[model samples]
Target chain A: EAGVVQSPRYKIIEKKQPVAFWCNPISGHNTLYWYLQNLGQGPELLIRYENEEAVDDSQLPKDRFSAERLKGVDSTLKIQPAELGDSAVYLCASSRTGIKEQFFGPGTRLTVL
Target chain B: AQSVTQLDSHVSVSEGTPVLLRCNYSSSYSPSLFWYVQHPNKGLQLLLKYTSAATLVKGINGFEAEFKKSETSFHLTKPSAHMSDAAEYFCVVSPSSGNTGKLIFGQGTTLQVKP
Candidate 1:
């Protein structure tokens, strides 16, 4: 079976510009997660969706970051007026409900100048 | 509270030699541990997992890890390291109680394989 799919493996944008990343989870997976990985560090969870409901978003920066998983299949993470500090890899992962193992995507590397 | 710490930021080993990467974890309850490997620009792949079943968990690519509750450690080891084993390895933990399946990852260890 194919793994999780993410679009635009790489993106570059100037500071203060809006950016968006998309993700499609593995088939039959009911849990989706968005994580931010900074250089020389492990990935930190930004948001998590159980089907179409976002159950965990405490780590997400609501002032500039927003995410949605409509139809419970695909997800989109958006950053409005992104800053240079926002430059990092945005990773998407999926897992079966109640499963502890998560499958990760290749991730989108965003470079903000 | 749950957290993980990788003992090494980088480890160098010659090809065909043994490889070891250390990891330590802290959790309020019995935790599910995992080892994940990530190649350059590639997604994270599951190398092995310990879910309270067997203390010795074997994974792909000749990798294996032993979970030691007494030491709060789950260290990855390989009898013979190959060039392809060079990558970033992360140690992760998920608390068993109130388990939302949230994974806590370590800083990661970069393995360098020498010829």
Candidate 2:
């Protein structure tokens, strides 16, 4: 089975510009998650979606970040007026319902300069 | 709330030697623990997981981990090191309560294998 898939493996944008990343979870999976990984650190959760409902998004920077998993299949994460600190790798993952083990995508490396 | 700590930032092992990466976790209740490996420029891959089952869990690529409740530790180990085993390893924990599936990850341990 194909693992999670993400688009624009690498992105470069100027500070204050808006940037977006896309993710497509594995087939038959009902739980999806977004994570951010800074250099030399482990990934930090951003948001989680159970089907189309965002069950947990406490870590998301609401002022500048927004995410949606419409139709319960694909998802998108957007950042407006990106700042230099926003430069990091964005990872997407998915798993079967009630399963904690996740399959991750290659990730989108965003560079805000 | 749950958290994980990788005791070592980096470890070096000679090819054919044993490998060990230490991890400790804090949780209010029984937790699901996992080991994930990430090769440079690649995404995280599951090495193995312990979910209140066997304390000794064997994973892919000849890696394994032992979950010790008394010590609150889950340390990854490999019988013998291989050059290809050089990568960053992360320890993770998730609540075993309602099965939310939200994970807390450790900083990470970088393994270096010498020829």
Candidate 3:
């Protein structure tokens, strides 16, 4: 089975510009998650989706960050007018419901200048 | 609240020598723990997990971890280190009582294997 897939392995943009990252979870996986990883730190959960419903998004920055999982298979995370502090690796992961193990994608490394 | 802490930010080991990565966890209830390895420009890979099973859990690529409840520790160990073992490793914890399967990760430990 193919693992989780993410587009644009790396991205560079100036501050105050809008950026978006895409992710396709593994087949038959019902749980999808988005995480942010700063340099030298482990990934932190930003949002979680369960088949089109965002069940957990307490960590997401609602002011500028937005995410959507339309069909429950693919997800898009968007950052509007991003700040320099927004520069980090955005990771997408998926797993079966109630399963503890999560499969991660290659991640989109965003560099904001 | 559940959290994990890696004792070392970086560890260097010579090839063919033993490898040890220490991790400590804090949780209110029984916790599910995991070790994941991430190569440069690569996604994280699961190394091993402990879920109230046997104290010693073996995983892929000749790695293992012992879960000590008394110590609140789950340390990864390798009998022999290989050049390919150089990577960043994370210790993670999951709340046993939650159905969301959310994971809390440590800062991470970078392993440097010297040949």
* Candidate 3 chain A lowest-lDDT run of ten: A66-75
Candidate 3 TM-score, true structure as reference: 0.99
Summarize candidate 2's per-residue lDDT along B1-115 as a digit string, tens digits.
7999999999999999999999999999999999999998898999999999899999999999999999999999999999999999999999999978898999999999999
Q: Which stretches of candidate 3 lie over 4 Å from their true place?
A: none
CAPRI quality band, candidate 3: high
Q: Report lDDT (Cα) of residue B33, candidate 3.
A: 97
Residue-level lDDT tens digits of model 1 in A1-113: 99999989999999999999999999999999999999989999999999999999999999999999989999999999999999999999999999999999999999999
| Candidate closer to the true structure by DockQ (higher is better), 1 or 3 | 3
Q: What overall lDDT, based on C-alpha atoms, would model 2 receive against the true structure?
A: 0.96
Off by over 4 Å in 2: none
* CAPRI quality band, candidate 1: high
Which lDDT tens digits does candidate 2 get at residues A9-48? 9999999999999999999999999999999999999999
User: After superposition, which runs of candidate 1 have C-alpha atoms over 4 Å from their true positions?
Assistant: none
